[model samples]
Target: MRAITISEPGGPEALVWTEVPDPEPGPGEVIVEVRASGVNRADLLQRQGHYPPPPGAPAYPGLECSGVIRAIGPEVTGWQVGQEVCALLAGGGYAERVAVPAGQLLPVPAGVDLVEAAALPEVACTVWSNVVALGRLAKGETLLLHGGGSGIGTFAIQLGVALGATVVVTARAAKHDRLRELGAAHTIDYREQDFVEEVRRVTDGRGADLILDIVGAAYLPRNVAALATGGRLVVIGLQGGRKGELDLGALLAKRASVAATSLRSRPLAEKAEIVRGVREQVWPLVESGAIRPIVDRLVRMADAEDAHRLVETSDHLGKVLLVR
Candidate 1:
């Protein structure tokens, strides 16, 4: 087997593709022969030694992948060897083979290619869990999403639209047209405009019913200010640093709430529940052509460093894949 290992984490160059021992499935797990893996900001964080894999997870850095099952472990059932599936992982997607918990596997949606399926699991589960399950974004509500051109953001935009919510996003000006095509009702250039004001203006001063933010402390005050009465703000990443003062008075006045979450460190049962929800609710939208994979480009598995570079630069529109 071959996997990308960090040769002392620092930069993309630290991700070294090298031969490694083959992974064997443990109880309730399955071995997947990876066909492709999606590049994420987390991968870059891991490479820079800022984020480490969870306890007992593979040292390699990847959060999602698409592959065929090679073997199933004890206590696992309903999935078989040779079945094509995409999986959400805590780590180790940047390898030719990975051992995955059975609960994390999702059948490839109808009409999606196996390689492209690699792009779905992480984004799907994240959006489904936060935007739908936690934020409770409903029809006629407005969602303001930061990093709209990102993998999770792109998926969130489409899913919000599919669920009948009005979607607004913040991204570079050049990406706005494509985002609008993906069902974003409005796009704000985060570089040049005040997203809080733009979101307010777009919603007739009502503010967003839900704001899905990746930027952390840097946007906290503005995010709270941009929320509608009784709105929810779900923060999934801390790209903008970690600490910030909260305005309890503002939150109390609007009856708004804020939650910060990460999928990688969650317990297995919770991840299974989220994956199940995604399969039942989100997969249908994908199969029906209401949502599709947003891949910026594909790189060979051996050149994962290049993929990481692309993701770090934020030059790509959606996911950057490392293919076998």
Candidate 2:
């Protein structure tokens, strides 16, 4: 097998695709012959030496992939070799073959092809867990999202719309129209417009009932101000600086809550739970055409360095996939 390995983390050039020993299944795990893998910002972070894989996880960078089951391990059931599946992986998606926990595997959603299915696991589980499960996004409420043109943002937009919430998104001016087409009730040009003000304006000054933010400390103060009474704010990414002071008085006045989560480092049992929730609640909507995986483009698996360069530019909308 061949995989991308970082001899010394630095730039996209560090992702070297070279021959490596094939992975074998362990207890409650399966070996997947990779067909496609999803590229994410985390992959870039890993390549730059900022993030490392969790203990016992593969050294490669991908967080999700679509593949065929080549072998099943002890204690695995309800799955078989040759099944087409997509998996939520701790690491190792950027490879020809990977060992995956059986619990993290999902059948390819109906109507989605193999390569595109690689786009689902990470974004779907993240959105479903934060927005629906934690934030308790109810019908008839307004949901505010940052990074609206991103892979997670696009998926969240469709999910929010399908769940009957009005969606408001923040992105650059060029991507606003496309986000609106994806069912965002409002779009803010974060480069020029104040998202806190825009969100309030679109929601008739009630503010958003739920906010999903990726810009960490940079947007913390304004995010609190943009919340409605009893609003929930879930922060899933820290693209901005990490530390910031919060106004506890403001939060108390609004009776709001704030939470932060990292999906990659979660325990396997917890990830399995998230994956189950996605399959049960999100997959039906996908199969029904209510939501779809939005892929920006596909690059050759051997050229992962090129994919990393593109992702860093933030020029593409939705996911960039690496295919065999």
Candidate 3:
């Protein structure tokens, strides 16, 4: 087998594809022959040595993948060998083969291409868990999603609309039209517009009922300020720096709450539950065409460096995948 490895994390040039021992299934796990993998910002952080794989995970830099099952390990049932599936992985999606927990696997939804299915798991689970589960986003409310052109952002837009919530997003001007077509009711150019004002304005000064933010610190104050009374703010990524000042007075006055979550290092049981929720709730939306995989481009696995470069520049409208 061959996989991408980093000896000394530095840049996109650091991702080296080389021959390695093939993975074997562990208890309750399966070995997958990789078809394609989703490129995420976490992969970039891992390549730069800022993030490391969890214990017992492969030392590669992918968070999700679509592949066919080659073998199933002990204690796993219901899933059979040779099944086409996509998986939510903690690491190792950048390889020719990977060991995945059975609970993390999802069947390829009807009406989706196998390669494009690679884009579904992570974003689906993230949005379902944060927006639906934690934030409890209800119909007729507003959902303000940051990074409208991103994989997670694009998926959230469709899901929010499908659930009857109005969606607003922050992206560069170039992506606004496409995001709007994805069901975003309004788009704000985060670089040029004050998203706090835009979000408030679009919701008719009521503010967003739920805010899903990827930019952590830089937007914290504004996120709180833009929230409606009793609104919930979920921060799933720290693309902006890690440290920032918080306004307790504003948050208190609005009775808003903030939560920060990371999926990669969570316990297996928790991940399995999130995956289950996604399969039960979100998969139907996808299969019904209410939501679709948004693939910006597909680069070969051997050319992961190029994929990383594209993502680093924020040039993609959705997921950039690495295909076998």
- In lDDT terms, how accurate is model 1? 0.95
lDDT of each: 0.95, 0.95, 0.95
**Which tens-of-lDDT digit does each residue in 70-118 have in candidate 2?**
9999999999999999999999999999999999999999999999999
Query: In every candidate, how many clashes are there?
Result: 0, 0, 0
Worst window of 10 by summed lDDT in candidate 1: 306-315
Q: Residue 321 of candidate 3: its Cα lDDT?
A: 97
- lDDT (0-100) at residue 324 of candidate 3? 95
TM-score of each: 0.99, 0.99, 0.99
lDDT of 3 by residue, 183-261 (tens): 9989999889999888877877889899999999999999998999999999999988899899999999999999999
Q: Write the per-residue lDDT of candidate 1 for residues 139-219, one digit (tens) a residue.
A: 999999999999999999999999999999999999999999999999999999999889889898999999999999999
Q: Report how far residue 217 has shifted in candidate 2, in Å.
A: 0.4
On lDDT, who's better, 1 or 3? 1
Q: In model 2, which residue pairs have backbone atoms overlapping below 3 Å?
A: none
lDDT of 1 at 304: 89
